[model samples]
Target: MFEYLTAGESHGPRLTAVIKSLPSGLEIEVDKINKELARRQHGYGRGQRMEIESDQVLINSGLRNKKTLASPLSMTIENRDWKNWKKIMEPLQLETEPQKLTNPRPGHADLAGALKYNQKDLRNILERASARETAARTAVGAIAKQFLAEFGIVVASHVIQIGNLKSESWSQLKQSANFDLDSKVEFENYFAQLDQSPLRCANSEQTKAMQKLIDSWQAKGDSVGGVFEIIVRGLPVGLGSHVHWDLKLESKLAAQLMAIQAIKGLEIGAGFEGASQPGSLVHDQIYYQPKTGFYRGSNQAGGIEGGISNGQNLLIKLAMKPIPTLAQALASVDMISKKAVSAAKERSDACAVPAASIVGEAVTAIVLAQLMTAKFGGDSLSEIKRNYQAYLKQLSEF
Candidate 1:
């Protein structure tokens, strides 16, 4: 099984992640991981902090000569802003007084976390709750992506909706075509086109409109959020089992997506829309060919049925609520004064759907990597490949 844990405050000297149980002998590419960290920082309407920080991952342990030693992997990304916050965030006692945050931001973890931990200063809660932690997760996911790539699995994401603006390409695909209408080759072309977009969106018109909304909201001291879709391709059938509820693929994917800050909703394939339709319209039709084996004509179930992969492109969409930290703060009560006050204001993005889309891809990759490892057990990449190839051969025979 694959698992990871992260440690660090938002303004701490560095963020750290420890990932374990990765198969041995898998090549590690520092540049590829750094590129993912860079992607996590890209997006329109990002805060000034993005400009101050150039995130680069340092692999402190687990690899020897750029290859995994089958041991725990440890990584870190230095927080450049730490220089300015050293006194405030320093671990040891300081001569200077610590900045105390009394007013909690609405829609953030500040108040809830502070109350739960019996903290007087909200900074104690907000530091770890900040989205900055996603940088460490992105680095971990980059490893999962590399591992999955060894088996031909690829993950990608694009913003489908931003506030009131929705991608026309997504609308077209949902309304005009069967879920399986596009071949893998065709989808790759679409992904290539979206990758060129500033917001990682497919439609230029919608993206422009979203950018305008972001600008308007920023000027108003507000923030906005929207939806992004994640797609995973080249997965073999039966990665997840229907035998146990916790082992279900959809369940695992949902938990991971919801863990990201501001994400409020998740959909798999035609999800909520399918709920309103009849079984005839919602269920994918099955088909089989001599060479292709079993397949689906549509994928309204999102390449998963009965909690198992059905050998089609996995589709998922995430909905993110507007970030809580606003320049024009919302109403709240001061923890110390016990009086009505405005919410705390902090440096934050007006919109982060584009960047969240990348994080979504990363998390999804990690889940799929876990499922793949579980299904094809091995302590080394070569052993896993051998096992997976045998499973493929068995499937072909079946």
Candidate 2:
């Protein structure tokens, strides 16, 4: 099995992660991980923190000569902003008092976390609850992406809706369209087009309009949020088991997607839309080919059925709510004084949907990687590939 845990405050000295149970003999590069980290910081509405922090991962363990050692992999990313908060965030007690947060933002974790942890200052909660932690997750997912790439699986994501502006292409995809989806080359071309966009959007005009909307919100001291779609291509059948509810791939994917900060909702394929459709329209029909084995006429089920992958492209959509921290703080109460006040104003982004899409891809990659490890059951990459090839042969013969 593969699992990872992250630690550190938003403005702490560094964010650290420990990823365990990776097979040995898999090559990894620091630049690849750093590239994903850089992507997490990109977007039009990012805060000053993005400008201050240049996130780069430092691999401390579980790798030798750019290859895994079949052990726990440890990594860290320094917080460049730590210098400004050193006196305040010092490990030991400082001679002078540091700034404390008494007012809690309406939609943030400040109030709830402070109360749960029995903390007097909301800073204790905000430090760890911040979305800054996703940077560490992006690094871990980058490794998962590299691992999956060896098996010819590709995971990618792109913005679909930014507030009221929607991508016409994505809308068309939501509806049943007769297209040449059986060709992997065709889907690769589509992914390539999305890759070229700064917002990870397939439509250039919508992206431009989305940028304008973000600029407008910034001027208003407000924020906006939207939805993004994640795509996983070239997955082999039967990565997840249907025997147990906990092992269901859809459940696992939903759990990870919801865990991301600011994400309010998610759907798989024609998820909510399928609720209104008839049985024939909602379900994907199966067909068999002499060369390709099994296939689906439509992917309304999103490449998953009975908790296992069905060898079709997996599609998932996530909805992120507008960021809670406003330039002009929301109405709030001062916990210390017990009086009404404007909520604490901290530097914040007007919209993070684009960056959140990258994070969605990262989390999805991790889940797929874990499924690969569990199914292949190998101590090394070569062994995994050997097992995988044998399984493919068995499928072909079946």
Displacement of the residue 217 alpha carbon in candidate 1, Å: 1.2
* Alpha-carbon shift of residue 244 in model 1 (angstroms): 0.8
- Each model's lDDT: 0.89, 0.88
Q: 39-148 in candidate 2: lDDT tens per residue? A: 88987788888999889999999999999998999999998888788887777787688878899999999999988999988888998999999999999999999999
- Cα lDDT tens digits for candidate 1, 1-398: 56999999999999999997689999989999998998888889899999999999999899999999989999999998887999899978876998799999989998899899999999899999999999998999999999999998989888988888887434357566554435667767777777668889877887889999999999999999999999888989998889999898899998888999888999988889889999998899988899878877678888899989888889998999998899989999999899999999888988999889989999999999998989899999999999999999999999
TM-score of each: 0.96, 0.96
TM-score of 1: 0.96
- Model 2: weakest 10-residue lDDT segment is 168-177
Best-fitting candidate, scored by lDDT: 1
Clashes of each: 0, 0
Off by over 4 Å in 2: 169-186, 193-196
In candidate 1, which residue pairs clash? none
Name the candidate that leads on TM-score: 1
